[model samples]
Target: MVSNMAGGQPPWHGTEPDAPLGALEVYAEQAHGYLGASGDQLGKLAGLLRPPVLESWLRSLRGRVDPMDALDDRGLRGADLRRYLQAHPIAALMPLIDKLLVEDTAATGLMVVVADQFGRVLSVQGNDERVAAAAEVGLRAGDDLSERRIGTNAIGLVVRTGRAAWIHGPEHFLYRMRQITGAAAPVHDPDGRLVGVLMIAGGVRVARPEILALVKATATAAEMDLLLTAMRPGQRDAARRDAGRPQPAARLGLDVLGLGQPQLSIADRRIPLSQRQAEILLLLAEHPEGLGADHLALLLDDSDLDNGTIRAAMSRLRAVVGPAVFGSRPYRLHVPVATDVEALRAALDSGDVDSALRLHAGPVLPRSTAPGIIDIRDELRVRLRIAVLKSGDPGVLRRWTSGAEGRDDAAAWTAYRATADPETALYAQIEAKIRVLDRRMGADATRMQRFGA
Candidate 1:
């Protein structure tokens, strides 16, 4: 592919994993330097916004359009570009462009043009002495390359084909393109859709391997910038949209069964139950098959509460908690009732990330006066944490802890982990004790909100 350039073969059709186009070496070196100096700061920002916003910002500032027309095309302003680029400058690309021009005397007569997805040039760079004659045609960056302008050049053709193209000398399809060489490549979004093009247009003799390679490399880095930004909001919204399809109601007995902690209202009737009465109703609700004393004891967290005590609890609970406390048959919790676990899951599956996170007010289980329900609560909270992570909204965590008046070290550590930053892990280890304290406090908070404390 390298040797066939003069005879009209396309520069190697596409990139090889290890061997990037030659000019790419300079850009790659710059990328490494930038990453090292800032720990990939731009990459971090890219991870927080959408692709379109990041790419448009880069083209105007780093690409350096004369009047910032690309920014205009992208619905951005010159001032905004100035401030954003100041904050997130493309340090690597700028000097690399300078080096490419200075190294090749023949190429010094050339210029580089960077364009957006629509192919309007955002920047142009070339030595004044080398490009003296070519400047007459308004070929500087920020010009549109439609049929009315410098027609049929590499920039326009790449935009048209959505592929890399080389228009050397007279091969340019336009009558006005007699003096230069252009090697262009298309830039794509994270999804691999075309978003822009990068091209090096210069004197025909300098249309060498390095120039083509550099253009391709810059475009790739810029494309990476675009992709990382989309992960912030779009990724989560797309996921939610995909998961929002309706689901059939859960199986009756499998999902949940129990009288709520507060006696549930039924037909305006008020029923009061003794502790034993409520315990029996809860045990019956927990299992589809009526539970025997051994299994009931295990579920109730009262292995020592003898079957007789349970029998008495069941009787009193039935009288008030159910139809009648201890009325001949013991009270039973019903199948249709919603357990905390089931309620949380339903909210999440319905795409309510906020609601799901909110439901987890505390640790799953607290040290309980009633051990059986406490175990269930503990298990429920574990599930809620997982659901929050999968929900993909960092804000949800913030809202969940909004009411906390003090720092919750464990929660803070978890938030840091959710961000996947290295610093948070170290902090988490140093504050291990805080995890227990936070859990205790979170439990209290959740109980107050959910169970009226």
Candidate 2:
């Protein structure tokens, strides 16, 4: 019957009356005894505890998790943090979660938490007093509630099992958490992929079996709302675009333009790529004829790595990108993959400077130092800069100069000075920068002459 509860249906429904409050109390007491028992006594106590709670406890013991350890609240911060908060598919569920769970339970000794698929808490909404109390235990936005991080909590369990879970009092792996009860249900996207978990936690004063139904119903409503929103006219086009046409394998897209970390998008999932993986994929895409392990290692700037090391890396990449996407014999992409670097090159080749600028995300894996990657990265930067300067487009020049890449670019600044309107403030700024550059170049020339270069 865990499945019944997971499906948003109470197991007791259409059967005998619900388990009495006394039953939960007894379960909590037994769980406490099990928690306090020594290694030898644990074997005897196991038979008395509920199967799910007992299994969870065993897992905690196997993992060697401490029952008194403080909770972890670390996660994404700054712009990277903002991006996840804004672009996550579960973002649409916030209002509904607030209305049904947070507001409804305010001042009732309860708190509502919403977390991403990885069990990193995205938002926490609840009664002010209860929220403060929860924060004392590190329960708040950006907190990681994964079972690996916090042991056997309901939010982490729901995320791990994709099932609704209710953990009361001593069922919690952490002794400090035993004063509360938690009920959580997983939220799925319209495509039926698990997106996040919605959890309600309350002090012992509000513990009740009915809380399970409330959490499940709220999750169901949030999912329904997500589906309905996706069906709306404005959202339908985007949904369709995201779904794409069915292909033999998911298309891979890489963005490695500038200073930002490179990201790989496989269908709807966008994952960050390690520098080595990015270099390998970029090389593979550049050489559709494929590369042997030796050549690939050289291209990766690691000549000492043997074939086995390369194979191990490829295996790890395969786990993320899928086996169908990578071919053996000669390592290369077996399926079609698109990258922003290629998009920019194509745009520039076709004389579409605007499109090229738009496609240029940042720099080609700016942190990468591999010889091949450096060549490609430098080539792309030079080509784009030359094209932008030659195009005589003020809009393009302005965009380039305004960004981090062009902030001190002498060529871009000179181009802007030549093309910009004299009446404009930008022209004055460019003029000042040109003077600064001229003086610097003059100083460099003097140094070279004085040093007999």
- Cα RMSD of all models vs. native, in order, equals 24.1, 22.2
Residue 74 of model 2 has an lDDT of 42
Instruction: Encode model 1's per-residue lDDT on 1-453: one tens digit a residue.
Output: 133214332223333212223423222222223322333454542432123222432342332222212212312235432222221213224445445433543344666665654455555666775455554544544345532123456776676667666655533433344466678888776667775666777764445667677777767766666666546575457436543211121111112223333233222233443444444454454443466666676777655768786676565444433332122323333323323444454444333455555564543323344677676665555555555545444455545444342134344335534644446754465345445655676755634433322
Tell me, by TM-score, which candidate is best: 2
The TM-scores, one per candidate, come to: 0.31, 0.51
Global local distance difference test of model 2: 0.72
In order, the Cα lDDT scores of the candidates are 0.46, 0.72
**Model 1, global lDDT:** 0.46
The superposed Cα distance between candidate 1 and the true structure at residue 281, in angstroms, equals 3.7
Top candidate, metric lDDT: 2
RMSD of 2: 22.2
CA shift at 96, candidate 2, in angstroms? Answer: 2.1
